[model samples]
Target: MVAALLPRERLLMGPGPSTVPNRILRALAAPTLGHLDPQYIGYMDETCELMRQVFQTTNQLTFPVSGTGMAGMETILVNLIEPGDEVIVMINGVFGGRMKDNMERCGATVHAVEIPWGQSFTLDQIRQAVADHPQAVMLGIVHAETSTGAFQDLSGIGELLHQQGMLFAVDAVTSMGGHDLQVDAWGIDAIYSGTQKCLSCPPGLSPVSFSPLALEKIESRTTKSRSWYLDVSMLKNYYTGGGGRAYHHTAPINMVYALREALAIVVEEGLQPRFERHREMHQLLRSGLEELGLEYIPDHSLHTLNCVAVPDGVDEAAIRKRLLNEFDIEIGGGLGVFAGKAWRIGLMGESASEKNVLTMLAALKKCLGD
Candidate 1:
């Protein structure tokens, strides 16, 4: 006979899948409802409104996509970019690289502007890129580069893009609730994020928003979007309300419940306070790590995710293993070029607390034999 499945709880201090709060878990366990049920539709509308509150945008088209963060990325690209459309992508880290790849897969002519992994692009570089690629219809960038813990500033870039007659798209997968993101104020035409990172929700849904300009661009696309499932035109009808609501696919009922609950938590805490909490936790962890002779990697690091350099002669993988085994704590190692050379410590959402920071520091000290 098959045994009943059970999983041990571990503090998630990794790059993602931040530790889910009990309230959110309970929300996930709520009874599932039919996708087209009127109650579920009401819940969906509430979720969209909550997303707007968190995103700080009045965008009517904001809603959660059915897949993870990457799905949100694809949805934005495939809808706005058609075959042979020129698009400029800023690539500084893994997620930025993924954006470039996604644009290419959409058959768009991509102009990729790259900087070092740990550094962010300046406004001058952005201006130069626009000058170099005048024909590009859209420019995509990662607001918080998760792989390298680098936070990109979107403050003035949005207005610049709009003035240049180019749409501004952003990947906020790791920054959404943890950082200050004003989608409307920043003039972001379109943006996408994941639930798992700073929302303190499970990995499944990707919340995305489209400005009126972005909607116009998507509507004006000469060719059909390559992805039928992620096509925003069909998605908007289902996500947006009114008497005429069409079903694109079966939405993830329980995940929506969980996200609704998580977003409610965000709204209750308020965005500024939530962002300050994350910053405080990051500072606490930074002080502790620096005391242990570690240094940060990013020029402008994300408060939600911290990437620190590992000391020479230390077994990065072994320390991670010991933390998981002996301390029942989970943290992340570096990716790509920083693999085995850095540690990616996340203090996202519910996991961003003084208790978790102190616990991780103490556990790490033991694992490092200090």
Candidate 2:
């Protein structure tokens, strides 16, 4: 017989799906509404406005796609790249590699710039890649490489690419609310982010934004996006256009509720203070980990996700097991090249608190002592 589903609750300190606030959970359980209901459409409009504020952009093409972060990636790529177009992909971690794969699937010729897993790409390297591929239509990069905790700087890359008449795209899934990102100020043409990482919400919706330049490219596509499900031109009409509440696919209404509440909390807290909170929490964890003779992996690490090298003779998997089974705390394991050699400890959104940092540090001391 199929039994009722119930999962044990633990402190979520992993790379994503951070602890949700109770208010957002209550919002998720609110009355269900039809996709085109006037009240529901009002909610959708308000949600887009909130996304614009959070993204620090005035772009009119901002909306939450009814899928995970990967869907956002596909949406941006498929809508912009037609067959035979050239693109420059920055691959310093797993997510960047995924971007390259998706670009290839869109039939774009990818010129990849590889870097060590725990390192961010240099401006000179990106400039050189652009010179090598002058015909590139876009440059795709990850702002926060979650797999290795490397924080890539996007300060000048946007203007550089825009000067070359190429689009500036970024994957900010792990850094959105936890780090500093000014979409309009930074000249980011198109960007996407996940709810779970720093929004203290579930992993369902991906907030995406496209500048007018990007929309123009989509409008000029030689062919329709290969994936109709992720086609942005049709999506904009449903999200906000002359069609007026037109139905595409059924929107994830409950996830939308949760996201709205989360964004409200972000507004209430303010962005700068929230980023400072993440910084302080990271410092606490870094000092404690350093005291225990642990070394950080990333050359320039993300304040939200901390990747540390596993000490010699210590069983990385066993330590993580003890932290979960004994302490009821959850952290992430490293991916790709850092697998088995590094542990990822995330201080993101609601989980980036002084108590959690101290608790994790003390718990780790006990486990290591044993």
Every model's Cα RMSD, please?
Answer: 0.9, 0.9
Which candidate number would show the highest lDDT if scored against the true structure? 1
- Which window of 10 residues has the lowest lDDT sum in candidate 1? 239-248
Candidate 2 lDDT over residue span 5-120, tens digit each:
88767888989888887898899899999988888888888889898988999999999989999999988899989999999999999999999999999999999999888999
Tell me the TM-score of each prediction against the true structure.
Answer: 0.99, 0.98
lDDT of each: 0.94, 0.92
Q: Model 1 shows how many backbone clashes?
A: 0
lDDT of 1 by residue, 228-311 (tens): 999888888899964377888999999999999999999999989999999999889999999998999999999999999989
| Candidate 2 wrongly placed segments (more than 4 Å) | none
Give the Cα-based TM-score of candidate 2 against the true structure: 0.98
